[model samples]
Target: MEQKIFDCAIIGGGLAGLTLAIQLADSGCTVILFEKESYPFHKVCGEYISMESYSFLERIGIPLSSMHIPMITEVLVSSVNGNSLTRKLDMGGFGIRRYTLDAAMAKLAVQKGVTLLEQTKVTDIKREGDLFQIKTAQGNFSSKLACGAFGKSSVLERPLGRLTAKSAGEKNYVGVKYHVKTDLPDNRIELHNFNDGYCGISKVDGDVYCLCYLTGSENLSRSGNSIKTMERNILMQNPFLQRYFTHSHFLYDEPLTISQVTFKRKSQVANGILILGDAAGSIAPLCGNGMSLAMHASFIAAPLILDFLKGRLTHQELCMIYEKQWKEHFSKRIKTGERIQHLFGKNILTNAAIGTLKLFPKLADALISMTHGKPF
Candidate 1:
């Protein structure tokens, strides 16, 4: 038997990895993508994407226009105290279930000749001379270049030296998600804040809605580690959330949950491997633009990876340029999201902020524009 090397090997099959794999395959590169989970799976996400990514997804073969997805052009924000406001959105987005979108992208990637390994876990990756030694559950493989799209938390973080002892114990955030049938407007997205957490609900494809939230881990501890208790005591305090909880029809037996989600800065280049998406730097979910950020990182990386494989750019140049570009585009956005998250989820401050923004609509527009970017 002969061992063959591919042009690129991507470790995760999220939006970043799938999009990058398809782009590289379209350019005639032998690309391999690994996804531990099978296709058409659910992720703990807001499932709302900014318009900045609409054209990009369309260009990449996602049939958003034909999917008849919900278009959101207005926002309804409520404080923990139930002080609420509704305002028009300047750069609205569309909603689609992650499984539907991800599965569509995976199909396109396969059609473009990308070898997608579903249910294949990558145990380790090492650099051997000029090639990357990729050891997975299936077998050992080699590639000219490797990518890390492993989302927010992964064992690979330690091996890549991206996690440290002190940071490991640092307080982490938890995310919860559900699909439901609600009477909320299909053209509007609502965000309701609670102590140490906030929830966002919007219309997705078909008649279902995506209801997702993020909170500090300590909140769960304070509630006896019970999601139902936390939701009833904390989240229901907001009249808006209470209405939805009492009236909506939940479609799942148990909500999808993920923990150890941190928004701290991450290395763009680690162990000589390129990092993209949430694994690189996750924006606060309040920003409602994380999907776009992840896809944009893939958009930024495809060409650079292509250049390196073609020998047009040296490895040092590729790493340096990618880091610079990644920071230039996303650093400020993440910082802004952090600041916004800080101001929300606190009763007094969030109520005052929402009250003020309601009186001054332009101020709300400016705040939104800060966390989002112009179309790529």
Candidate 2:
């Protein structure tokens, strides 16, 4: 019997991969997704998504309207020394845990006719002739095309030599996340800044609030390479963070953490594999629109992928157009995020900047606008 070949094989089952699989399957294409972890797992993410993707997610069958997700409309930003500013959010967002959202999207993908393979890791991908050979832990498979949605850091990325980099001598970061029971308004998101780091807190599904932070790797090293030491000595120095840490009921004994998190730009098309989400280009987490950005990449790639599968365009054309569109949509947003992140982290500088932005609310709104996008 001849081997079955899918239209596309997706590696990684996060938002990008799962959403892409659903989109392709909805359009009558065959897709098989490979994920090393099972559904409903936790990830080190802030868990806030810009409203720009609400309608798109619904259009793709996420049922966000029925989920009763928290709608955040205000932002409270504090400086390293606890100087603070509050502003009404113009392009507000909502908070949803990756544990809930990714699992929901995974089920939606399977319902949409995409083959969902959980606990299956893709060991390598090689393009030979016109098809992609996907070697996985469960078994090998072939597809007309492949996508890399294995966000942030992945062992599979090293062989492609796309955006893989050595962490040594690089300015990397540590991301720490927790789901806590805290006293915070569901309609507001708070960002508390400390030396070399910032923490974001907002409500998610049910009564849970997502408390997540990002700090320089050097901060951990300076604290004896201990996450607890770093949080107590560095993060707690901020008055807002200290209060939350002291008062909140932490749901986990140990926080979820990811190290060597770098925001370097990556190629969208590499070695015939289309890259999506943080695997393509990671905006600084300070922007708070990463989930939307990742979903938008799928929105852009879906139709073009269908175009390629239906022989409306050549493979080379698909790669070129997707790269161009990805850059056009996201390059400015990512650059703005990087620039704004630089404005944070320092005590005196952030103090002055927040004071000035507070004095001029329109300027603050404009800065936020640059980091976000319109509803798709």
Candidate 3:
């Protein structure tokens, strides 16, 4: 078979990959995207996105105003013992499931003339001269540029030497998600802390609530690897969590889970492949703005990529600009999230922090601002 070379080859059809593909294709770049999973699938995410990317998504054809998803404007945080604080979000967000959001983006990418290869896994990528050779289950393909938007973990990372020795020990957390019928307020999102992790609850589309939590893997092993047991013994200790878990009707037959979640630092550009989203770096879920950050990264990367493809910028120049802009926008936020994570999951510290935030609303606002960014 004759090899077809694309202008850009994107791996992982998540928010970052799909959005970037659409932007480049709109600019008349020949784009091809590969996703191991089919469209309209669920992912272990909090399902809430910060409002900073609202305009960007609309520009890319996602009609947020028409979606009727809940607009979350207030935050309610609680400690392990159920002590709570409520704060108004200056720049609020909305909730939509990954199944809905990603599927919509995929459909739009197809409509915009992108060669989207769904259910195709990219096994390897190698750079030869100025082009990238991508090997996949389907066949060999080539592109002027390759992007790694694969979320969190992938086999490709090992071959690319993107992982350090510390990475092997870094994957210590487990994330679990479920959609449930609940009576949570539509205009508010809540974070409830537990022994070794935290849970976020918000109203997504279809009048259902997204209930997702991240916990230390040790917590699961201590409970014999049973999610229910961990929830009962550790999560239930929080009064708010106990009430929700006891009352809400879980929509899933079994909760969706992903293990080995880590917040370790990652390189944005590796082996001549431009990395985006979780593949680049993931913030602690406590921040509640990771989805926005992922989309924002694509927003920042697309222009530089277009310049590189147009010969207006060299690959080195493109990488330098993208790395600088990405760090300028996200590095501090990720670090702040890591610091904030330290304040949760413990009985005394969480309660104290909640109490302090409640007493000093300005401090809470400052902390929230630190983890979020201005509109792009």
Candidate 4:
């Protein structure tokens, strides 16, 4: 029997990989996707996407009618000292959870004729002339071009060889989130400040509210077998948070956490593999724009790769183009996110900043724009 050769191989079936695969399939290109996990997996994310993603979703023939995600029109910033500011956000953003979004994209990819290999992990990858030989747990495959859409750190980064310095920030950071049934305002996304971190609350599909927060890992280490203990001890420092936690009933069994998410920069491409999504670069968790940026990058990368496959662009040219495009579109935004990460990590600074912003409405709007603008 003869093996099939794909024009492009996509390793990772997250939103970025699925988006690129759907676009290429519609453009009549052969793409093979390898996913390590099954569908509808939960990821530690803010779960908000800016309006920039709508155009790309439309192009892929996905009507978001089923996604009852709310539109957040305003941002309210509050300090622990009782000072607050509210701004009318310039661009509207969606608050859909990743579980719904990822499954929908996967279904659309299959409908668009993409060959998906779910739960098939890629073990090793090496170059064979101009092609990439990908060894997966299932078997082997070849493709002229390969994409690294794998989220965060993966086995793929090892062969690429230390692209970025490891983040040495306090490894005590942890993110816990839950889908809750609450009588919360659907149109507004709230960010409440706690002791060492903040919590973001928004309405998503089925009118269930998604609430997530990042806190110190040591806080949880002392808790005895309950997320509630961590929240009460570490997060209850703020009276506002204490009230919310005590008042709002949960919609799930308990909250989930992702420990020590590092945010040092990573390479866009290495050894003929193009990195996409969190694989290429990760914004700080508090930034809340990583998923939207990934979607926007996928929109741009698919067309660039299509041009390369049609012999209109060389591989070097494609790599250069992808890197240039991403940096041009996202460089400043990422820098801004990093800055915010540093500023908000300290309780005194965060409270002072929020208090200062509360006195100036226009300045508060400017700050909101810096964090959540719809550039890409």
TM-score of 1: 0.98
Q: Give per-residue CA lDDT, model 1, range 298-364, as digits (tens).
A: 9999999889988999988999999999999999999999899888888999989998998898999
**Candidate 4 residue-wise lDDT, 46-69, digit = tens:** 676767676667667767755566
lDDT, model 1, position 70: 94
- In candidate 4, what residue range of length 10 has the lowest lDDT sum? 162-171
For model 2, residues 8-84, the per-residue Cα lDDT tens digits are 99999988898899999998999999999999899999999999999999888888888988999999999988989
Report the backbone clash tally of model 4. Answer: 1
What would the per-residue lDDT of candidate 3 be over residues 1-376, giving only the tens digit for each residue?
5778899999999999999999999999999999999999999999989999899999989998999999999999999999999999999999999999999999999999999998899999999999999999898889999999999999899878887776454548999999999888899999999998999999999899999999999999999999999999999999999999999999989999999887888999998899999999989998888888888999999989999998999999998999999999899889889888877898899989998888999999989878878888
- Error at 130, model 1, angstroms: 0.8
The C-alpha RMSD of each candidate to the native structure, in angstroms, is 1.1, 1.2, 1.2, 2.0
What is model 2's C-alpha RMSD?
1.2
Error of 2 at 310 (Å): 0.7
- List clashing residue pairs in candidate 2: none
lDDT preference between candidates 2 and 3, better one: 3
**Candidate 4 lDDT score at position 209:** 79
Name the top lDDT candidate.
3
